[model samples]
Target: MVVPAQGLPASVRIHEVGARDGLQNEKAVVPTEIKAEFIHRLAEAGLTTIEATSFVHPKWVPQLADAERLFPLLDDIEGVALPVLVPNERGLDRALALGADRIAVFASATESFAKANLNRTVDESLGMFAPVVARAKEQRVHVRGYLSMCFGDPWEGAVPVHQVVRVAKSLMDLGCDELSLGDTIGVATPAHVRSLLAALNEEGVPTSAIGVHFHDTYGQALANTLAALQHGVTTVDASAGGLGGCPYAKSATGNLATEDLVWMLQGLGIDTGVDLGRLTATSVWLAERLGRPSPSRTVRALSPDSHKE
Candidate 1:
């Protein structure tokens, strides 16, 4: 590991979304047993917060249609958080039926993205989530709110900082434990990230209550994560093996890979509680299942016989 960097959090809590967000956009429907094993491997690799699946309509996301079947198999796994996405009251109800303790609600910072993704306007979407968040909190289930397109949107060019702050605050006010600001299109630079964090702070949203989910379309994920860390944001979201892209965002690409994030955190001596070798091996294994190589550069570099020491 490299020496620790200054002005950074001593440790970061990586919310791994590979199983959910990563596989959601894949064209092939991964087998339910494979999904179960993937989640198991992730936990074995020290990923405590693994997003298992989304409880959306089968017509909307056919890949995760087995949420009901997949969730039950995770019951034997101990000491790990498997959060599933709940889009509405029904989704929440389904998750609760399966004894889900951690849930995530997703919304967009841009009106176009909201309408296209959720078929509702910004305010309407939040209104829809109000009761869902309330009921989840009522059930004592942990809720994470996702604010997509926080930096830029495909339909709307550059998103204003206030827009993101407004949506984020609304989610927080609705009882979300943490708001994950997503650069859904991967257009955010480090400066943009800093400005957004500064603006959110000015709006009285604590850095502690924020996490960042960046896409690597422009290869700025790590740089932007460093910016977020410097601004005192301790939670960061990453997908294992760079496995995800926003299905709703046409210009978007894969998410920041867990292996890449782990490499950087390990090099900086920042604790993420992930085992890099096992993570790399897992990603390689997953890539084989997906019938392609992982998009993560770190995984490629660290794979056996891929490079010289």
Candidate 2:
């Protein structure tokens, strides 16, 4: 018997960051089990790539102090590739010790953001990535790169497209599997997204190697994502329940909401392989756990209906 054939799926790779980058700065520390389960639930929902935890120092980000505790519990979850952030040699040693399957390193596009956010110059930060990427490659672990302030910087205002392209190309050359372009301050417009992507494309960075991380401060995240998608950005970084903010940015809100992004994709005839009802429920669940209103409009719209069923 032959199964019915369908048209090409509207493919998109969404990188869920709620557990690490999303909840890094939460005032109340989420339990290690809850964080782990939240991650498990997302993987069960068809997210292939999830940022599970970070190995930064406990004194630096107290909320994620449990990376060691939470990381090991996630063993043997099929179909999901868990990657944790490693800021330096110390962090890398810890993750490698834990047998991390993948790792990510970051650098800022602006000099001020580089120093203030990571306490290093752009050159120094990129320099650090060299060894880390090399070590991860030795261990057969996938390495990813993050270029923060790719769209706009809080301290420096508008970031140059040249800066973004240079950093992205440099990271790709450093042996990164992919690069996530972060709008740390939520100040990027559609025009900004387009211009940056155009510059990268001109520089010969394959569209497949780029990802977008947007914040919703001015409600431009979704719009910017649309612009990015139009320009061939197939990978996106979003947080469940809109769960994160940039600790380095004074007034930025959460990253782009997963439910909202999924909604937009569904409406535009894209296949995300996500259960909207479940995703929305999880968003609301996390928001309620945090004692805050949800940052996702799709979650609000769908949660009650899912419960009615």
Question: For this target, which candidate reaches the highest TM-score against the unseen true structure?
Answer: 1
Which residue ranges in model 2 land beyond 4 Å of their true spot? 1-9, 304-309
Residue pairs clashing in model 1 are none
Writing each residue's lDDT as its tens digit, candidate 2 over 67-146 gives: 88998899968888899999988899999999897999988899988998788889889998898998889888888899
Model 1 off-target regions past 4 Å? Answer: 304-309
Top candidate by lDDT? 1
lDDT of candidates 1 onward, in order: 0.94, 0.85
What local lDDT score does residue 281 receive in model 2, on the 0 to 100 scale? Answer: 69
Query: Candidates' TM-scores?
Result: 0.98, 0.93
lDDT, candidate 1, equals 0.94
Error of 1 at 71 (Å): 0.2
